[model samples]
Target chain A: MKIGAALCVLLLSVIAVHAAEIATADRKSGFEFMGRDTQAMQTDDTSNPGMLNVLDGGALWERPEGADKKACASCHGDASQRMKGVAARYPAFDATAGQVVDLGQRINLCRRDHQKAPELAYESRDLLALSAFVARQSRGQPIAIADDARSANALMQGRKLFNERMGQLNLSCAICHDDNWGQKLGGTSIPQGHPNGYPLYRLEWQAMGSLQRRLRNCMIGMRAEPFSYGSSEFIALELFLMQRAQGMAMESPAVRP
Target chain B: MPFKVEGDAIQRSLTGQPGDPTEGRRIVISRQTGLCLLCHSGPFPDERFQGTLAPSLAGAGTRWTLGQLRLRLVDGRRLNPDTIMPSYYVLDGVVRVAPSFAAKTILNAAQIEDVVAFLSTLRD
Candidate 1:
């Protein structure tokens, strides 16, 4: 009887070990999605047609939008200066709000406080262009989010969210994107969810948008409850993504698909 | 080039033309575009690198009817919605939003039809 019990315990332990191994293998790796890592090609060419949107975004930046008769240009003249390194600093901790905020929320707050304009909806083009222009300021700068107590706590939550499998497919983003990245899923190859060249023109979306919008889309694809626009979960995930692409340069107003 | 024969014929057949399986097999196995072998195993026994994700298509025809196979190609996720497999052909029901990916199917309707024809001929 004791022998049988011992064998049962051994078998259970083996199964547990096997399951853990699979789970560990399913997590996403930070480097697997880099364009340079996949194939050395000119991912960001100046001649690409997508650059036109950035120019349009620049125009919109100076256009007045609020009841206060103000524009983004009203307070921060030439974002090229005031917003330098702003993108790298985003998905940052907000002390008064006591939470993390995305670039969009910050813009909205600025619009409300200074320009007296109502907030734009999440994923709106004006917001996208404005954020893209702002992110452009930090071009080539490595993302530098602080790892203070608040951010550390946020990152841990984001990691749990990334690792946890919540979709109807019973697959985490880590499973295909992280584990099976180089491999094919369906007919298409799964690219890493890096934000290096965001506000990108994805052939799939056929438009320019933010990394937070992409994250929301992924959550929907996974059948999970997508975080509200500029939610802490979204900000935390953005922070995690920025850290993942820490050394990679920003590719705002990027093209995709 | 030879693989394209089956693909061309199958496309023609779907649009009402002739397709050759031998040529179709050649194209499906090639590296450039129809790298089907990267994800599925087939009768190309000499081809050593078989992907680990899905079951081999070598005798897939023997197990599943053509209609079932067609559905898998159309959108494997529909029958098994949890499937990571992307739909190769079927139109109509697709996510129509930000990025319009409707036209970028790896296999057009004709290509999928030709591949299916090639699979049918693999009953050895």
Candidate 2:
């Protein structure tokens, strides 16, 4: 009886440790924590314009749209391996450029440098589609941003963006999201501003969009002058939001009311 | 059985229109329009497990006088420095928001009274 009891206690301890290790695995992987299931990354097939871009992006990856004979597939191989877990770590500071770069900027960079393709317009359908395709490859990976000095500075700037008072509304993101969560602002329930699920399908937007676009919408809501597309401020904000949503699982392509 | 309670609660009518408490109940609970139940707990007949984010309004009428509640619904943060409550009645001159909703407040004056009336009915 004594031996059996001792064995049971030992087994329980082992199980507890194993559970904790699994929970923390994503932190080690350089991705934010995420659910085991990858389906959360799926966009609406018919309704979302982003989904349409996915089809176009997949084709773009395979087809040679550039002047060069080499397609993205020619070099990258199956995206499942070549591009796996790439998107979650983007908006990373590049030492070479001395600036933070998002997946979109990097894709454009690759096009210019390696593929010799003309750069796609910012926030254009081609860009959105390509981003969607690449982001899809990292469906189940946790979103992980580096936490070094550079990332810390970027996060600070992002937090300022979040807390800053702006626009004709005399409102800040903190007022609506932090102070007024669960409360009604206008007609809608102010949801906690978790960036866990992004590139989401918002009802008002009536399409799928990146978190940066959503941030722009929030600026419009506050009546603040929105930054131009592909701004450093936007990228820094993205890094901050992803870090805030650190432990939360990726709910990319989530449907919002 | 329903019994009339004397001056249970009263509020100033913005549009000089008396409000129906029953209609007010429907609006507060409705998910799309008012959605007050999402954050607040009251003597809502059907709702259970009220959200834990804010204080329950189950017996708010007993705690605050009708006039006090009226000011709160109009704009509560004026009383509390860090209130999350949105002003439901008073216009943007009191609390400015965006211009698109300039002519709008969450609830009209009538609706505020109606909600207050419904709140007063909760004795237990």
Q: Each prediction's TM-score against the native? A: 0.60, 0.62
Query: Top TM-score: which candidate number?
Result: 2
How much DockQ does model 1 earn?
A: 0.05
Docking class of 2: incorrect
Enumerate the chain B TM-scores of all models: 0.69, 0.72
iRMSD computed for candidate 2: 13.6
Where does model 1 sit among the CAPRI classes? Answer: incorrect
Residue A149's lDDT within candidate 1 is 78
In terms of DockQ, which candidate is strongest? 2
Stretches of candidate 2 exceeding 4 Å from the true structure: A1-56, A67-70, A73-78, A94-98, A109-125, A148-153, A163-208, A213-233, A247-257, B1-23, B26-35, B44-52, B89-97, B102-118
Q: What local lDDT does model 2 show for residue A218?
A: 87
CA lDDT for candidate 2: 0.64
